[model samples]
Target chain A: MSERSPQRISRSALPYPYRADGLVFDVQAVLLDGEERVDVNVSRANRRWAFPTDDWERCRIVGTVELPSSVVDAVYPESERDSPPGSLYVTIRCRETIYRDRWMVQSETVEPKTYEVELELQRDGFRGEVELKPYLTRGAADQSTDDGSYASSTHARLASARPWTMLVDGEADADGETGLDVRVESFSTSPRLPKDGLYYLDMGDPSDPLIVVNGEHNRVVGVLQSEGSVGAEARMRDVVFDQIQYGVWSQLILHAGVAVDSTGRPQYDWQSTVLRIFARDLYGIDDIHAASRRLKRDLKDPTTVPEVMQRIDRVLQRYLRQREQLINLMEEGLRI
Target chain B: MSSGDVDTDDGRLADNTGTPLRTLTSEGRRLVDPAFLRGERTYADEVGQYVDEHTSDVHVELQGLRADLQAVVDSYDQYDSTIDAAAAPAVHRRLDISRRIAADPGVWHYLAVVEFPEFVRYRWEFNTETAMREKFLGAGTDIYSNALHRLWWIAELTHDGDDYSLTEEVLQKQTLANKIFDRWFARYRPAAVACCAKLVDESTEVAEEVTLRLNRVFSTRQLEGMDEAELGRLIQDLVTDIQNQGTTD
Candidate 1:
């Protein structure tokens, strides 16, 4: 690879769409005020960073994100109705990396019903795990919304009770494998996906084996729990079942937990929903109408490893033909 | 054929007649002032030694095709005077020279920029803004824009398997040549062949419309895995639509 730095062109200067071939990110900000979980769905999904040069190494990310209305309602003060509150502040952190400046919430709207509380950020960095945590300074408690309503002293949550969880939907790795891996689906994070690391898959079945990842030791140790005879084909089939469970169920859960970050649905909905349906059909899972809902309630309550894995098998059997066709397309799309 | 037997006399590269020639290094290619490329520095040794290292086997091949190239050059002034008449021989010479030698861009760059600096100067030799400099040096430049590279690529793209008749026909129409470089699909062998075979007898206007439509269609469609039959079907549909539109208008 050439040592040349990856060239970052503005969205306007792009020869092709940044979204079609650029890195896509969907950020979901979950505001937790004690047990009350207020989900703020924010999307900047349309922005794409295209590295046209061969041997691209890095690119600069420059974009703005608007905090959802739910976030504003969560932080608004009820005590003072006459005087508008000061600028609300929030800190967005991703894994170990944190932006130093607290993003101020501009309560005023340039247009009616469109309150602009946008965070303008510019960084030369790769997309990684991101977490947004909103903070209420002493001045922020007095801040007012555009309609000039003060927060009720009793109900206004001054600070984020817990870390805002960003749910990351999975992406197909066209450069390597086509579909998601079992470990990747389990550890899905928001903003950007982390490099594949260690994980544990506990099917919860007493007889089936457990897949465990020792992160510190950097190794995956599988323990066989079943004493019964297991054929080679049966074991291979088990592995495929685990992969489907991870790819379909885990991604479905993540999608349920978070909202898409783009202004509207992406043009390539076919790649996401249609293809995912096809994949699910391979395992005989046929809840197409339920899965289409933007937010799935089942994602909030955690399901056991055994149950999800079993669900994948059931779904794979439902739409065998479509699943095979999708797999063929994905295989053809694979370069290496 | 061996470069070992070739002379290192005064660090100069040589032609087939044992005349000392010039070659340029990769580094010299970047640092050589645009003014120098524009003929400000007329020193004989400017071409450098890279040419000698790479062109050992190509010496005889280049010699055989030299007369055909010179014929095209001789008729350069007659293009505007004769219109479509001058382009056929020129296209024929290009196909002949391009087929005779290896069509590596690096080799063509060396031949057009360094080996034949005098020829480059003679053609766009006096044009300002270092116009000839862009022709020799710009990376990812269309083969149509570069002096030697354009001729070779046109021949390579339009040739029908082993035959050069398709190449001659395509290049015979000046409008097609001008618009040909922009057709990204033409870079594909099957797509190029489909285009040549389909438009072999069409008028320049029809060819222009077809080329324009193909470019627009290719921009949005993921036509990578498409076979020649599929591409032929698509091209025929497009050509039919264009002819229908022309008649309707």
Candidate 2:
């Protein structure tokens, strides 16, 4: 097959000129290779805030697609291009630590694939996915009478829902169905831990959809939702383990940002471990910030997971000296 | 029509609160606190000018807009109907304001908690405290719940480019509008247009069924990849099935 259309590369770290705030990430791209290139500018129009709340930032993709060289040659053949020949189509994939969400502009038919395109995608800390795809119009050419005006682009969206199989690990509600199984109880909890059943371990928030199944020897095997905050997921892992009470080992799955493993488990990596460490301190403390108010007020509760993560990290910090090894272990197994 | 030159003393302005309200708030903490509204600071005549200048093309004053909104609230004792009518004008007026002003919760905080406290009081008489403190401050997508923000968003999602006839269609049925407002899929313009057309032609019961079925289809499939015509055809089939089911019922 023709070079499988260059699978879009996922950057471990955000490309340069991109910034990630608490819940927002911002990116920008300009024309890279086209006779007449379209300017792709992506940015969040709203302000950024923390997670668990509906503090979603509505980002936008805006740019112009000029008439392509082939089309210009075919139409005017020998005149200075005055008006935009067509509009740009944009698609953005916002990868988060808990889940990978995608937002794509309804694609437009673009003719000859010879145009160069560039874009900068920005989101808040909540959404880390940022890559822009732009192409010239293969669809009907612009009917604008004006010689050189630009066309309007579409809005950016945070993926509201994805294929459930894409996020959770379980037998499909159907024989082989996927997407959000809003009603599946495959991952759930009970008072008496069943010796041989799958259950969603009890995180502080029972409503969280992350799946935890009963593993061998009183342990629970579960994958964290890769789309959630690294800090939040780590905290959930810690809390779920503690709530299940002692003697039950917590085999937590980690992730590198939002990328997961083949079985839909969160991939463990050094970045996620470090992020979890930060979350433990910031959230583990007693009311340092307004966002941490609930953690402080409810610290005394049995379900209220406190910060023992840092203590554990310090111990591991001695042996797992290099971040690369820790990162690899996060993806592979680090049978300690 | 610069926002810095509105006439606060205009007879039409409502001075419901005896104390003056602050026009601009730069600090985050003070922005969320209700105490900021009760400070020594007073709203300058110029501060009031911002709304006038922003909404000049709309030609409606805050006092008039508030009264018109209150009238809708009064007539349609049903919450949904009242919201549909009341929110449309708010969205129309907001379209006239700068996005910079509308995007900031601080500006809206000043409008709901400070400048228009009486209107806020009128709208949510039973829970004014919660309404002013928590609801007024835009929090997440829930910020759309704010009195001003809610209307603007409802309009944003329902409107087709500059044509808001679709908004009017959605306003007639609470089920259709609520689904459109809350769900991201419904914000897809083609989908919204298709849903509104179906809802407008059907009964409330049929509309509900169509919306539910449509949502189920949307959540699973990638509606983003479908073009306008493709979305229209898909929604039309769903509407037809619901209609056939309704007839059998």
Candidate 3:
């Protein structure tokens, strides 16, 4: 009787993936292209986004798609029974919305006739926990589910089975969802750039702190983005990221300290938040008051400018744990 | 969620269209300057630089969408309710809705940068000045920020197959779209349409209250694993509850 309510249908009224005969995808194992075959956990499949750089390769999902003929008959209308009742196209779809590439190795129309699949995933920007499921699509071309049906896109999803998720663990540097937005930008266009260093932190946007990696020098976008991901360029990437973090922390702390000195506190909330979180995590400093106290006190010879750099270096040594991180950096070199 | 689009022509809109739908990484998204997004730079400006490192054979055509969007923005001076009502359906149809491609941050990034820079700039009010970075980059991930993506997603969620009535209703106010999208049921098409239907006609205060109540109900009642009968029953209960609140008021 409510005027606001529209024509209400029972929840089951609309066709909401309601199929009496649903198919299941039994993903057996994952194969590194032309190399090692890693058995899938059935629950979730995981392939590293981080391996070494030179040896990096694409991955493939190997599985069996099961659908009894009775299911095929029940779901699809008879060959002569209706108009263009499209074929059931089957494949594994990347359930991650953030991934750039969702193109699977293949998609196929599996009759009771065909069942096996060996689909490949293009190793471009593939990271994090990627959930893949054997999906049933209504239209588009056909082949074996994972084997021959590899395509970039598929049509209307007919049904979805229990999804299998995979965790591709990589280094900390490869994460994109961090508070600090680290980027690779060519500084040649930034005419007013004060420093043409390996990296520069653009602190203009008080809310969003940016770390611009100077592409003018090394142009190692891969090393920076990929880091320990599928292509493990571990040493150089780790050292670069470490140095960048150090610089960012030093500049921010210095800026916060200067702001507190002039006024009562840091000019921005982000400054306060970062000082509290990072300072606490990296150093033993707990509260903002303690941080404020620490920032005002200086290294020996407080009047001297280079002394600030000296203090930063001393803190960096502790944060980096001179022996630990540096040792990890050299472990790669020693391997070479 | 009903991806009814079939392949047309050389499969530009189809699943098999082997054209790579390019994307920019989160890091790459930061490199996108307001000037670059305002169509001041071409792909040669390295605006197309830092493309997601994918070897997928699929490629997407970076067609010019500036003139069309310029007309809309020039005429309306907004992501104005009027503009959204007209534009969402057009954009949805043009992109040839496929959830697989629709959900890719890279595809939206590519479109915003390589294909439709003006779309992002005009929508986010990039008038020779910087706008928020998330506005340019947050497609596919965030429900609200990305100008181009939210349009497609809005149209996708509300439109009954071949019907734009609900989409137009939701787009009647930007705030309403936010209310519908910011909920757990936003991804579920039926629930989204139901929520829009329930809220579209109510006063702003009443709608907001109902949505708040629904949010509380959703927190305790997970919608993910629920089937149609159960979800329908739950939604029906909310509708009755909303009617009672109307009576109370």
Candidate 4:
């Protein structure tokens, strides 16, 4: 299994030169693994720096760069003089590198290294550029003293590798006897971060489908484990969540091993899934764990169906009764 | 382009209130402010002070653009007498501005620099009125308002990466174009919007068919009864059928 390299550094340490007349300005460039590069600029005029198109033209680099394409991307030009502003920023993946000597060096004895370059310019002209030296220090490795319970990296890897899936348990014919008698036990919400551990389910049978329920905020609300290779899944965590303070929960259904229809769309019969009951602001870890355990136990127990359904209905009714309040909560969250 | 007799501060042109119009010029571009443009003060501010100090040939050129726009409206009316009369005036207003901006890049640059809230406000007002009166149909929708918004919405509703031609196709169909604006305020998901657009394109029966189906689907027990995954799949299926029909037939 391949693990993504962890590269975290501050803005100051990154390389780049900066110069300004009367306004403050800064620029940073990073060359990643000798395969990808990124350049960022921030200036007082626009307070945002963008990759200069003339630079690429002057550098005469070949292969496609990671700038937004004018054809597919629509932009309101700030001024006619600034044509094809390249991008407000750019991350160029290496089809090739111009500097052979400046390649990323790695060794068995050393942790991975990252190099950054920065430059700042004023209205007049070039200000300064800085080159960030690679940080060679490594953090402590996992030890036995750490918590015994660890997250499943297999699930994480799979989630990242196969981010989209179709739901099978939800697809079971509602009118047919084959439908699984699934019931909601308990429901709780948790804040999903930029990086969240993944949990995998093998439906035990290849014929059965996996069901995922996503919420409105794109959170994974529930997962229905069915029997099979119905390979539908979603990224357990989303990249967008990195910058957002408030998280959304989604009800998703994943069906495994589905093929695209003639129209380049997925073809799958998703099963019935419902968000019967929900609890809010249960921010404590213990509270969430307890709720999950309760739900799992109730789902396993056939006798809890009527009670679960009643509780779900009650919660939903309460929510509907407080629709205005819910809206206010959402608005408040947005303000935050 | 040159106003030799024009007073620097107080331009002679005055509104019905008898106050001289403020005038500003920068890089040979002239701006006359009956009302101040929003945002930070620039050369326009200096010109307003200049107008306050002097009162000659204040708004001769400013009035010229206004007259040019009115003339364009009159010409459009002459060209299409039977066109929606209520919409014609507003459409002409926008067309006049667009034409001027297209022809004289300096005016366009000045417009950009001034950052007048009134300009945007009036443009939006005209756009909304035209859209409402015309049943939300017209190529003018993209040309008259924020070009960025028009381009984005067109790209979004059209089939993936196929909007280059479909944009024109969508704009040409008055009924379909109207439907786009009608549903602009609807609370449907992003996927739902695409589905609706696809449905409109796939069928010749107009947007009513798809809209009616969507309404019925939402109102039925299916919407509340089905799980999220189920709803997504069903919607995807409908959209797929529509898209398939669009490409094939």
Which candidate tops lDDT?
Answer: 3
What is each candidate's fraction of native interface contacts (fnat)? 0.00, 0.00, 0.05, 0.00
Q: Which stretches of candidate 2 lie over 4 Å from their true place?
A: A1-88, A92-115, A118-336, B1-83, B98-101, B125-134, B160-163, B200-222, B227-229, B245-249
- How high is the DockQ of candidate 3? 0.05
Residue A8 in model 2: shift from native, Å?
Answer: 8.6
Q: Model 4, residue B88: what's the lDDT?
A: 29
- CA error at residue A295 for candidate 3, angstroms: 22
Which ten-residue region of model 4 chain A has the weakest summed lDDT?
A154-163
User: How much does each candidate deviate at the interface, measured as C-alpha RMSD after superposition?
Assistant: 26.8, 12.5, 12.1, 26.1
What's the TM for model 3?
0.49
How does model 2 score on DockQ? 0.02
Least lDDT summed over 10 consecutive residues: which range in candidate 1 chain A? A16-25
Which wins on lDDT, candidate 1 or candidate 4?
1
Write down the RMSD of all candidates, one decimal each: 28.7, 18.0, 17.2, 25.9
Q: Write candidate 1's Cα lDDT for B1-249 as tens digits.
A: 233335433233434543322234444454335466656774345444444454423233343234545565576752242222333344334334322133233455555566445545545544654455555653222444445555556665565555667766666665666665556566555677678778766777887888888766654332332346767777788888888988999
Please report the candidate that would top DockQ against the real structure. Answer: 3
True contacts kept of 2: 0.00
How many residue pairs in model 4 have overlapping backbones?
67
Give the CA lDDT, 0 to 100, for residue B198 in model 4. Answer: 59
Q: Candidate 4 overall Cα lDDT vs. reference?
A: 0.28
Q: Which window of ten consecutive residues has the lowest lDDT sum in model 3 chain B?
A: B1-10
